[model samples]
Target chain A: MNDPIEILLVEDNSSDAKLTIRALKEKNLCNNLVHLTDGVQALDFLFGRGTYADRQIENKPKIILLDLNMPKVGGLEVLKEIRSDHKTQFIPVVVMTSSREERDIIESYKLGVNSYIVKPVGFDNFFKAVSELGLYWLLLNQPPKL
Target chain B: METLSIEHSISPNFTKKDIEILKMYFELSKKYNPVISEALTADLADHPLWGPLMKQQTPEQRKAQNERSLAMQHAAIYEGKWEEYSKDLLAQGVMYAQMNISYSDWYELIKMYKDYLLPYIKKDFADSAEKAILYLEGLSKFIDFAMYGIAEAYFAEKNRLIQANEERFRAIFYNSMDHMTLIDRNARIILVNRIPSHYNKADVIGKSILGFQTAENVETVKKAVHSVFEQKESSVFDTAHLAGENKLYYSSSISPIYSENGEVNAAVIISRDLSLQKEAEEEVKELNRSLEIKVEERTKELRDVVKELESFSYSISHDLRSPLRAINGFTHILKDSYADGNEEALDAMDEIINNTQRMGHLIDDLLEFSRLGRAELKKVTVDMRVLVETVIQELTRVPSERKIDITLQQMEKVTGDQNLLKQVLVNIIDNALKYTSKKEHTLIEIGSYADGGNIICYVKDNGAGFDMAYYGKLFGVFQRLHSASEYEGTGVGLALVQKIITKHSGKVWAEGRVGMGATFYFSLPKPRK
Candidate 1:
């Protein structure tokens, strides 16, 4: 197992998360993809608190895939906290969600999201979108040295 | 008669010395006659009532009248004959009546006679002051008797004149064109003149006025009559009557009549009918009320229809699309996992996915079309040139390989909702670009001009033009002249354009020739100067 998470995916839907992980694996990009079902656990992992208190803070993921609609501690609130704190400000956060509403897109960009992607209905399109995004953020895109 | 005259003398106890003084007084009067005569004649000539006639007399006749008045005053002072003075004033009163002089003018003339004699009497009796006092006392008494006689004659003449004038006024009052009624305090009609053909004097007179008027009028009349009696003042009110099918209106005035003690005893009510005027007014009021009710009903109906449309739109957005997206997603998954090895199964899955996707797009477009109707217009001055350029730039973003020639002419500024007009331009220009994709060198033109008192805007395209015979279906939702294979469209674009144009109080139309080209035109009213 990897020592630190390379990617953290915060999504409430199980099928959507499985499909996303499958796409990244097909591209051989998921060496260490940490999937959390809701925003609370995702925040716990990122800030090294709650269930993830034993983990080190410096082992933050290279990128976060956040879904806007969730049961507790929604994606926007998590993004706002990540941006305000100096420890996680530079982490490349991308919004990946099923909502294609203009208001949601605008709010994600306003919160300094690195990229926004609308989940396509067809599996083929979804697979292509997730894989391309994974390849771009993990491989081609540069992150600050940790 | 001569003894009676002597017995009626002003002073029978006159001494010989007093008689000599009187003879000298007459001589002194003659001496100052020229000086006193002009002032006396000028005063009478300028009198308000008798001036015109007196001014017409010759100077000699005026002097003679003045001399005659002075002689009469001299005889009254010398003999104390007040009766002769009274007789002279009576003769003057007769002359005053014949000349149509006013009572005020007669009084003023008598005062002038005394003024002319005062200085002459003073100068004549300067030697014997005691004789002067006696003569002046006798002169004042004689003038007082003359005044009493003048008053008696003047009033008799005044009464005769007033009687003649009263006869004329009576004729006018009784035969006036308008109906006049006099009612007592009990709301009883006491006198009614110029009665209509259907009403006799006996029918209206001594009857309760409340019977002739409507209930509302009766209340108004009662209030007006009560106020008149309480305040001892006059008040007017309008009342209406129904004579079979005809409606008669009248304006009645209530005035108080006071008895000998100066206390109000009764009221006089005068009514003037205004049925024609009142009928016209009532008709107009009824018309206005009915029109207002009609407008209110129409507005309610329109609101109900709008509410229904809004709910329908809400269901389409929330309920229909979620299931469609699920079907499309699951079908695509099936095609990828199990059906990939079977070409027929894969094809069937692809068909389901495509149909659902089309349905989703159609729903979105329909929702937008409905929203446009309900959207509040935020009007601003829109530059059509910038709007067109922006829409074209957006449409050409993907970079089509087909050579496209786009021309933008001089466009006018229009006042409309910026977002809505932007949508209108986008839909139209987008159609132009989509249809012309098959052409080798497609030409699209955008321009505007002033026509028919409005700013006319148009988009022309060298694209797939349809038969004019199918023009009726041009802007109908889901309507299509061509099949999906020939040209792809949900058929809501033109209908949306029509709706948006209609909302702006503008008009939209199209002209086309099959296989040649088509142009869509819309007009907006120019901003008021």
Candidate 2:
């Protein structure tokens, strides 16, 4: 409880995921974090299934940093599972990805993602988007206690 | 000595001898028409019926004689002696020979009098000497009167028939519709009616016409003559003359005209000009070709107008969305940061933000859909099995505690625009998650199979399903089957899914019951090898 998981980042692009984590850490928001590179591994961590089966299931993060493009079960699938179950459905989830495709944004909100973020191609815009998303989801927003 | 012998054998009285000679003449002259030997008029020229009378009758007696001959033929006068009859008949024969009276003329005169006199003679003079004597005398006079007239008419008619035939032939030769020239076997123009009469006619008629023809035409004309005259084979040839008004395109064929003995007498050359008709037809063909070009130009102009209209719609959707998106983004920020202790206000503001976000999504979707319509598909064989799994992974990147049991049933890799297919899957799975949010547990499945060379994939969810009544609202831009309060949505997710799938030459649709779950299915063609 002292170091509550503030951000749970799931993405597959090493460069993009690293850049996002770095931007969030620069703002001192990445200390309480759990990062998964793919949807299957991310799913396992959330439900304590597969490799994360030994971990406690009751540990809920304050905000999840989601990337839309990833291998195996992706950001959208993770969002669906989060919103479907009574235990995890109330946790705040934000979609963050390099793709700005219209469907990606609409689907994120439809699945009850608290916010949708598009990773910018340019260095300055990428920094600003990551910093803003981390601040809004982790420090500013209040989380519902389960 | 011969005179004495002939005299001893003859009659002594000159009057009696003359009478005997006339009788012999009369006997022969009674047989008329020497061709058919039908007697019509009895004695002609030397008949005693006229000449002896002419020798006796004064100028004053001539009318009376003509009257009596007419009167006897009419049966009004009948006076004649047997000896006079005999003498008249014999005398007519000699006179007929002297006049050179042909049987044809004698035949005509006899036919004329047959209708007038023959019936009366047959009825009244059948058997008696007196009647016979009357018949002979009447016929002799008729023959004498008719002979000179008939002989002159015959000669005149014969000459006229010959002249008429010559004139008819001359007319055809001079005014023939086809251009004709008569040439001897020597290739000389013996006669040329249509050609200029003064055109060296004397030289051309006897000498070879090859000297007068154009240098090029001379060889052609000679070849034509050899073929048409010597070889006796007819041929047609086209000749081009680009000179002045006399210029003609002549198609001529010559045939040898033969004599009765089958010797080639002359070659008849026939030619006709078709230059004007051919020129008119060529002009019509040129006009039609130009008209076709004009039609094609007009069609291209219409296609350009259609393209302009399509781009106009795309721009409108894009420009209109930016401000609406700002309204949505700012409203959410206000609710989060500044609505302290005002629960109802926060709730109201959340609702407003939600609607604005929905509107923003609608605008973006409409623009994207329009863009896809024009975008050229970049086709590639994406490992779609791995691709869908990756999309599913991205969707689940949010909260860590929710349990999503994803059964990927025999997924197959497919060919498509990789990016578009990923977007399509993301939208569909995300939609299922939104509907199933209230469920105690959620079950989602991503599976694929093949149908008739197309790869079909399904995303199924055990969730709160929409009623069949509102199914029409599915996959339409900004048309939501579920309320925002129940499970939040921009209503454009399925529509965007469908568009992306369609852009990849695929199709998307869904099936569900009200309280059961929904399943989205899409199909795409395998890439051509």
Candidate 3:
């Protein structure tokens, strides 16, 4: 089977997504990645529907990078949606957001997010977080598979 | 007639001088013109007893002849001596007067006649005219004796006059209007002018006052008496005389009446009744007690109402948020899914979202204000100097060139809730920044002091001060001195700050002049926590 797509980044902001993908690639951690901007596109990519209908389900990412405060379904709803499905429930997802509210942190955890992080305010910190996250999840990640 | 019967029966008991004095009284009474003229007719008609003697003698001689001379001759023969004859007659006459008069008047009359007539009678009766005069004197003596009997009647009338006057005085003394009495230092009444029937006629005059009082009243009377004596003053007690079972009285006063030496000789007590005054006082006390109970009950009811209001606000706030959050969260979904890439439409929707967030803030502020009503005040010592610094840091908003330079003065430690005080600082500082948006520069300050036991902290800002007309709206919920368009706020920041400060047992107020910026002040206790 084709190598399962790696690093499925669910982000709505095109500039932030481009900057994130560039940062991950600069670290040589991007391979066979799939990016979807909204909950509809994200669901389709995961379930192999429409254009991705013929896509193999076993070729799935080891972990998902989720962005909250997005269009359509935000990160928390997306986290819940993934956790409820038997096929995707075992996949690890990390939530990142601009809000530092404690409520958001607890809810993300409650929805089975593997980790939660605040979106850094400055460009340098954002670049460093993407580099670190990419190297950990795409390279050295020890995710469970069945 | 009664005397004649007694005399006829007892003539031997009367002596010679008694008869002689009796004859003289008869002779003297007739000599008075009224008696002489009346007896002349009776004589002219000639009484049968004196007619033979009267024919043998001169008429004046017969009228005044020897009834007394015969009685003296008889007394002389009885005594057996002529020299002591008059003395023996006088002694015998005194004895006869005692037996005849029975009381003092007749004896006095006998003595009076003997003193004048005894010597003359004792002298010679041997002269011839004496024999004829003496024989006629017996007839005169009989008339004189009858006049002395009439004099005794007049004496009895004079004694009656003295007794009548004494009875009048006795009536006035026993029935005087005032409770007049003569009392000794021992409080014994020597004389009580009232209630004479209370005493035996003779006993009350010298008896103690106790005789008038029953056993129960004695102790009460004694208490008054002891006070008078101890104070060495005459006292008057107006008190109830509990002589009978149902008796009740109110005493007005006890006053000491003094003698010249200031020693208490007597106490005259006058007691009045008090049932009316006692009843009135009891009525007033009852009214006061009932009024207090009513006030207490009213206060409890009011407290319960306030608690209910707080609970209602709480539930309203909590329940309102659930739906509000759903609206906001779903709006996010719509904004993400349906915005048609039109920048203007997206921006308008963002504005709607921001307004909803502000509405949420307003609801939260309302909840806080009402919650303050139910929350108890908790006081703690707070150092405003460090507190203001921390607040400014949290509210700094990553300080840009638009930052405010708020100079802070050293503040004294004050007793208040620390978290609540921090909110007050944040609200005031943020308000300064919001108001000074149009200004080239912004400034604010914080400080405190010991104003009596209270520490007065103040925040001063150079900002767009509001009109004085809106002063009443300063601390009210959703009240903004300026319009929302002029200043972007939910108009709830100051209200929340005020609520927080109030819950800490502190007071907050503001002062401002148009165009001159504003100063907010609060006073909290500086007592040890």
- Find the candidate with the highest TM-score and give its number: 1
Name the DockQ score for candidate 3.
Answer: 0.02
lDDT of 2 by residue, A16-72 (tens): 666677678779988878888898987888888999888776777777777776677
User: Residues B1-529, candidate 1, lDDT per residue (tens digit)?
Assistant: 0011112222234456655655555566567777876777677676566567767888888778777777776766666654666666655554555456767777776677678888777777789889787676555544455666665555555565567678876786687756666667777877766666777778888888788877677788778877877788888777788676677777777778788899876776666667766678899999999999999999999989987887667656645655665677667667777885898898888889888878877888887887777788887778888988898898889976889999999899888887889889989998888888788999999999998668999999999877899999999998988887788889999999999999999999999988788999999877656
Candidate number with greatest DockQ: 1
- In model 1, chain B matches the true chain B with a TM-score of 0.55
Expressed as tens digits, the lDDT of each residue in A19-77 for candidate 3 is: 67767877887877788888767777787876678888767788788877667777788
Better of 1 and 3 by lDDT: 1
What is each predicted model's overall lDDT from 0 to 1? Answer: 0.78, 0.66, 0.65
Residue B24 of candidate 2: its Cα lDDT?
35
Model 2 chain B poorest ten-residue lDDT run: B1-10
Q: Per-residue lDDT of B117-189 in model 3, one digit per residue for the tens?
A: 4334444334555543653465345434433443334344334444655787678655544455556667666
Clash totals for all models, in order?
5, 33, 25
- Give the least accurate 10-residue stretch of model 1 chain B, judged by summed lDDT: B1-10
State residue B352's C-alpha deviation in candidate 1, in Å.
Answer: 3.2
- What DockQ does each prediction reach against the true complex? 0.13, 0.02, 0.02
- Runs in model 1 deviating more than 4 A are A44-58, A84-90, A121-125, A140-146, B1-119, B122-138, B142-341, B363-413, B416-422, B433-447, B460-483, B511-518, B527-529
Where does model 2 sit among the CAPRI classes? incorrect
